[model samples]
Target chain A: MALSPDDVARLARLARIDLSQAELEHLAPQLDVILESVAEVSKVAADDVKPTSHAIEIANVFREDEVRPSFTAQQALSGAPVKESGRFRVPQILQEDE
Target chain B: MSGLVLQTAADLAGLIAAGEVSAHEVVAAHFERIAQVEPQVQAFLALDEERALAAADRVDAKLAAGEKLGPLAGVPLGLKDIFTYQGLPCTVGSRILEGWHPPYDATVVKRLLDADLIIVGKVNMDEFAMGSSTESSAYKVTHNPWNLDYIPGGSSGGSAAALAAFEVALSVGTDTGGSIRQPAAVNSLVGVKPTYGSNSRFGVVAMASSLDVPGPFGRTVLDAALLHEAISGYDPMDSTSLNLPIPPVAQAARSGEIKGYRIGVVKELGGEGYAPGVLQRFNESLALLESAGAEIAEISCPHFTYALGAYYLIMPSEVSSNLARFDAMRYGIRVGDDGKRSAEEVMNLTRGAGFGAEVKRRVIIGTYALSAGYYDAYYGSALKVRTLIQQDFDAAFAKVDVLVSPTSPTTAWKIGERLDDPLAMYKADLCTIPANLAGICAASIPVGLSSENGLPVGFQIMAPAMADDRLYRVGAALERGVADAFGGPVLNQLIGSPAWDALSAQAVAARFPNIILGLAENLS
Candidate 1:
C-alpha cells in the first residue's frame, strides 16, 4: 500500500513505459491512494473463498479447422508503424555488441 | 433538431417502412441538424456524411424494390469510437491510435449496418475508456446538451451527449464499470449494459475484457431495446460470447407491464453519500412503481459495497494485459523508433509518449498489483471479492424478480470538478459496478431531474444474467408512469428545470430547446 516514487518507477519499467521523473512523482501518490482504498478487499475476503477471474465460468470453445477468408499481408501491415518486404519492420530484438 | 429527426428510432423506422419518408431524407435531416449544432456540443469525433447518405440511398433502394428492411431501418446512429469500423479512424480517445483505421468492422458495427442503421459518425470517449468523465479524451470534451457547463458522463460521454443534443436518435456505447449507465443517468437518456457476452467483442477494443460490454443508448426504453436486439446474439469470433438465443428485450419493452412483479430496492446502494434530490427522485419512482401494481422492498446485497474497490483492481489488471498489444510496431502511431535503441527501449519510450496520464496510471497500478509478492493481496483478493459479488446477485435474484437503485448518487457535475481526484470520480460508479462484476444485465432510465443541481438523474434496474428482459419490463412501465406524471416526454420535464438556466433564452429562447435549440441561435 505504501507506494514510493521508486516503486512506481520500477512498476512503470516493468510495464514497458518510460515515465519522466515528474510523471512518476505525480502518479505515485495517486496510485498509492487508490491502492490503499482497494486494499480493503483483502481484509474481508477469507482464504477459503474462491477467486473469480472471469464473471462467468469459461469452458473451452472449439471450432472446426476450416480455411476462411482472411486479411492479406498488405492489409495486415496497413496500420503498422513500419513495414518491409511482406513483413513487419520492428526494432532489432537482438544485441549486436554480444 | 427538427420534428422528423427528434422522433424515436422505432417511429422513424415505422415511417420509412410505411413509405411515408425516404431514408435519404431522414439521413439528410440528421446531417442538417449536425451542421447546425455540432460546434457547441462537439459530440462527434468524425461525421461520415458521404457514407451515411450512400447507406441511406441503399435503404431507400431496397424499400422501393418492395423488399423487407432490417430491424432498425433508416435510423441515423452514432458509434462509440472504441469499435473497429473498417475505413474509419477508431481512436479510443487516445493519441496512440490517432490516425489508425482498422481493417475490419467490429461484430457490433457489422450488425448495426445489417440492421440498416445509418452510422452518422464516430463519437468521443475517455482515452481507452479509462475515466468516468469525458475530460480524459485526447480530443474535445463533450458538453451536456441540457447545460453546456456540465460534463456528459463518460467514457461513453459522446454517445449520451449525441442522444441528448439530437445529433442522432440512437447510439452505441460500451459499459465498463459505469460508463454507459452513469452517462445515461447524467444526460437523461436510456442506456443499457446488457449481460456480458450477450454482445460480441470480436472487433471491439478491449479494456477490462471481462467487464467491457457494448450496448445501446436511446431517448426511450423501447428505442434502446430495439437497438439492443439489433446487435445482441452469439458470435463465433468472440470466444466468450453466450451461445444461447438473445433475450427478447424488445418484446418485453412493448409489454410495459410489471403488475404482480416483485421489484427490490437495493438496501446497500442508497442512504449515504446520496444527494437529497436524487433520493427524492428514487423514492418517488418506487412509489410510482407501487401505484403501477408492483410489490417493492429493500433487498440487501452486502458485497455491493466492495464492488468498486474490486473493480479498480480487476479492471486495471486486465488493462495492463490487454494494452500490452499497443507495442508500437504492429500497428498504431509509434513514437520513439530512432533505430539506435533496442526494441524494449523504443517500446518504453513510445508507450510513455503515446498514452495519456490516466491510461498510464491504471496500467502501472495494474502492473504493481499483478507483480510478484503483491499479486495475492491486491489482484487475487479482488477476484475472490468478484466471486462474492456474483453470489450476492444470485441470492438476491432468488428473493426478487428485479433489483432497482438510483443509477448514480448525484447528477452530472461540472467538467473539471472531479478531474484532480480519481477516488472521488470512482464513487460515481458505486451503484452500477456490481452488475458488471456479476456479468448481469442492467439499464439506466431517466426518472427525473435532481432538485439539488437541477440536473437529470437516472433510475437503474438490474436483472439476472440471461434474464435481461426483466429490466425492460419494469423500465417501460416506469417510463409510462413518468410520462403521465410529468405530462410530456420523460426528458422534456427537465427542460424548464435549473439546468436549463445555463442555456436560457436570455441569450436566445428555444421556441423548443430540445427541438430547436440550434435555431435558438447565439446559445453560449
Candidate 2:
C-alpha cells in the first residue's frame, strides 16, 4: 500500500496534472496512508455483491432525431480560454513532418 | 418588526405577497446586510447588485399587475458557485474557473428564477465541492457566523454561513458527501440533500456525478423545504434526473407530524469519536420524537463503517473523470499556450496551476484508483462496497420509516484545526455519507448547541429515496419540538453571544464604517 514517488508521478501524468518533486514526495506518503485506509473496502466487498456505478438504475435516454435549439457557437466559445473561428483552440497535437 | 434581512424566507414571501413589503425593499435590505457582514463572514464570491434589484423590480411589477406569485417570490437566495448562472461568475471555488462567467443558467438556477427567487449572489465553496471544510476554497475563507475563528462547515459553508449571518434567508448548496448538511449542522440551519437525481445536475459543476446533489439551506426546515420544492424536479438535460413528481416536502413541513412513524437510530453512526454534546443533543431530539409518538428502534447498519472508504474511492474516481473536461483548451485558465508546447503539456501545466492541493491530491488518488492494473482492487471494490451500503439502507428502511443520526461527528472546529490532516477532515462526513451512497434523501435540522463548545449541533433525519416528504415531516416535527423547548430557534441563542457581537463590530468597522457605531446593535 506504500505509494512511491514514481507512482505519484505516474498518476499525475495520467491525470494530466503536473506536480513538482516536492509535491510528489509530500503526496506519496499521504496517498499511501489514504490508500491503505481505503483498502478496507476490499475486505467486505463479497464477490456475490454486484458493483454499482450509479445509485439508481438509469437507461440510456433517447430523444427524437430532430434539430433543437442549443448553445450557439458564440455561447459555447464564450468561456473558452483559447478560441479560433468559434472553435476551441488547442495547441498543436501533430509534430512537423519533412 | 424583525428586519427584512433577518426574516425567514417564508415570512419574507408572506410579506411580499401581502404587499406589506416590496421585493425591492427585501433585496435592498439583504444587500445592506451583506455589505455590513460579508467582510467577516466572507460568504459571497460574487454579488450582482444591479441584476438583483432588476429582478426584484420585476417581482414587484408582477405583484402590482395582480399576478400570482410563487411561494418564494421576491426572496433573495445565495447560490453556491457550483451551479452556472447565465452571465454570472461560476467559479466552483477554483482558480481555474475564477472570473469565468457562464453563458447559461443551470437548470436549478432557471427553476429558481421561475419560482421568483432573486439571485442575491454566488457563494463560496470548497474547491469543486471536494473538502469537508470551506478552507479549500481558493478565493477566501468563510468564517462561522457564531465564532469568527471556527469554520462554517463546508463545502457549502458559505451558503450556510450566509443564512446564519442573516445575509440571506435561503441559499442553494450541493452535497457530494455532506457539504450541505455538515455546514448546515454547524451553523444550526436546515440543509437538505434531496434524493439523488431528484434535482437536475445539467449545469452543475460535477464533482462526483453519482454523489453530487444540489440541495437547499435555510434557517428553518419549512424554508429549506420551500426552496427545495422550488429548485428540484425532473429534467431531460440530466440523464440521471429522476423521472417522477416532486415530493410534497413543503406540505410535510407545514404538517410537522411524526405520529406512528418508525424512526430508527443507526447504532453504527453514534458513540466513540462523536462529541458528547452532539450525542446529547441527538438523544434529546430522539426523546422529543418519541414523546411526539414516533416509535424509536436501534438499527445496525453493519456496512456503514466502510462507507467513508468506499465514498473516497468512488468520489475521486468520478472526480478524475469529470474534471478531465477542465483542460486548458475548453474553458477557464490556460497556461503556457504559446503555440510551441503540445496541448497535453499545456493541459498538464494549466491543471497543475489551476487546481488546489486538495483537488490535486484527489485527482492523483483517483487516477491511481482507476489506473489500469489497480482498477479492480480499488474502484471496483469501492463500488461493491457501495452496493453493500445500499443494501444496509434497504434493510434498515424496510424496518423503519426513517433513520436518525447526528449530522456530523462534532460541531464546527477551528478553521486550521484539520487542514493538515486530510483523514481527520474526511471523518466529518461519516454519519452523512450513507444517505448519499444509498441515493436516499436526508436533512439536518438544528437540535441544540453543543455543551462542549457552545456551538450548534444538528440532528439528521434520513428517508428512503423519493420518500423525501418523510425527511421533512421528521425534521419539521423535531424542529418544532426543539424550538418549543428552547422557546425559539436554537440559533437565536447566538444573538447575545460576545463572539457574534465582536465579529459584527469588526465586520461593520472594516467595511461600513460610515454606518451605525455597532452593526450588532441593529442585528439584535
Candidate 3:
C-alpha cells in the first residue's frame, strides 16, 4: 500500500507526465494515503464478485462503416504547431515505429 | 418581473405556452438577470446572447404561427462546458483546450435543440471535471451566490451557481461522483444524477466514463424532472446508453406524493462527523417526511463505508484510460514539437505541457492504478468493491423503496479551506458517493440552512437503477414537505447574504477599524 519514491517516479513515467522533485515528494504521501484508504475496498469486496466496468449492462453499438468527408488539408494543418508540405511534422520515432 | 426570475421552469413554460408571456420576453428577462449577477457569480463561460434571442424569437414565431411548441420551448438553460456543440468551443475548462470547437454536436445537445430549449450559455466547471471544487476551473472560481466567499461546489459548480443566482432556469451537468448533487447541495438547487445509462454520453468530455451521468439542475424538483424527461432516452451513438423506455419524470413530479412511501435514511450518513447545523437540518427534514405520511427507518449498507475508496480507484483508472485520448494529434490543444521527434514524442510533450496540476495528478494516479504490477491490486480490486457496493444497494432496496441521507457531509466550506488538501475535498462527497457507485439515480434538494454559517443544506433521495422517476417523485414530495415546514426554502432566504457572518464581521473589524455595523452588500 505504501508507495515509494521510485514507485512514484515509475507512475509518472507511465502517465507520461514530468514531475518536479518537490511535486513527487508531495504526491508520494498523498497517494500513499489515498491508496491506503482505497485498500479497504479489497477487504469488503470478495474475489467471487464480478468486476463492473459500466454502470449499465450494454454491448457494442457501432455505427455503420461509411466514408465521411473531412476538413481540407489546409484547415487540418492550420492549428498544428508545425507543418511540412501539407502534412504534420513530428519528431522521428523508431526511426519509423508506425 | 422579479418573481419571474424565481419561477420554476414548469411555471415559466406554462406562462410561455399560454401566450401570457412571449418566449422573447422570458429570454430577455433572463439575459438581464445574467448581466446583473454574472459579475458576482462567474457562472457562465460562454453566452451567445444573439443566438439565444434568435432562438427565442423563433419559438415566438412558432407560437405566432399557431404551432404547438415543446414543453421546454423558450426555457433558457446552461450547458456544462464538457458537452460538445458544433461551433462552441468546448474547453472543459482547461487552457490546453483553449479554443477547441468540435465539428459535431453532442447527442444530448442535439436532443435539447429538438426539445426547443434555448441554450443561453456554457457553464464553467472543474478542469476536465477532475476537481471537487470549481476552483480548478481554468477560467475562474464560481462563487456561491449565497456567500460569495464560499465554494459553490463542483465540477458542476457553475451550473448550480447559475441556478442559485437565477441566471438560468435549468442547466445540464454531468456527475461522475456527486459532482452534480454536491454542487446542488451547496447552492440549494435541485440536481439529479440518473441511472448511469439514462442519458447519452456521446459528446460529453470523458471523465470517469462508467460514473459520468448527464443530468439536470433546477430551482425546483419538477423543473429538474421536466428537463430529465426532455433529455433521457436510448441513443445509438453511445454504446453504453441503455436501450430502455424513458420514464415519465414530469408526470411523476406532478403527482409526487409520499403517502405510504417507505424511505430509509442511511445509518452511515448524518453522524458525528457531520457539522451540527447540517445534521440538524437533515434531522428536521427527515421528521417532515415522516410527518407527511411517509415511513422512515434507518438502513445500514455495511459495504457502503468503502465506496469512496473504491470510487477513487475506479475513477482514476477510467480517467487514465479516457484522458489518454487527448494526445494532441487526434483532437485539440497540442504543445511543443521538437519537429524531428516522433508523433508519440510530440503527443507526450503536448499532454505534459497542456494539462494542469490536478489533472496531471489524477492521470498519474490512474496510470499507477492501471499499471502492470498494480492492476490487479488496484483497479481489479476496486471494481470488486464496486460490485459489493451494488449488492449493498440491492439488499437495502429490497427492504425499502429508497434511501435518504444528507447530500453532503458538510455545507459549503470557504474557498481556500480544503483546496490545499485534495483528500479532504474528496471526502466532501462521502454522503453522495454511494449512489454513484451503485449506479442508481440520486437527487439533492434544499432541506434547510446550516445555521452554523447560515449556508444552504441539502437532503439526498436515492432510488434503484432505472427508477429515476421515483427519485423525482420522492424528491418533490420531500422538497414540498421541508419547505412547508420551514416556511420557505433556505436558498431563497440566503441569496446575497454572507454565509459566515462571524467570519465576515471579524474580517471587517480587522480591515476597517471604524466599521461597527454589518453591511450585507459590502461584505460580498
User: Best by DockQ, which number?
Assistant: 1
TM-score of 3: 0.92
Sort candidate 1 into its docking category. Answer: high
Q: What is the TM-score of chain A alone in each candidate?
A: 0.92, 0.88, 0.80
RMSD of each: 4.9, 4.8, 6.6
- Candidate that beats the other on DockQ, 1 or 2, i.e. the better one: 1
Measured against the true two-chain complex, the DockQ scores of the candidates, in the order shown, are 0.84, 0.82, 0.55
- Using TM-score as the measure, which candidate wins? 2
Instruction: Report the lDDT tens digits of candidate 3 across residue range B23-119.
Output: 8888888877776666678888877778888989999899889989778888999999999886567789887677666667888999899888999
Q: State fnat for each of the candidate structures.
A: 0.87, 0.87, 0.59
Predictions ranked by TM-score, top down? 2, 1, 3
Q: Model 3's DockQ? A: 0.55
What's the C-alpha lDDT at position B27 in model 3?
Answer: 84
Q: Report the TM-score for the A-chain of model 1.
A: 0.92
Tens digit of per-residue lDDT, candidate 2, span B39-119: 888888888888888999999999999999899999999999899987677788898886677888899999999999999
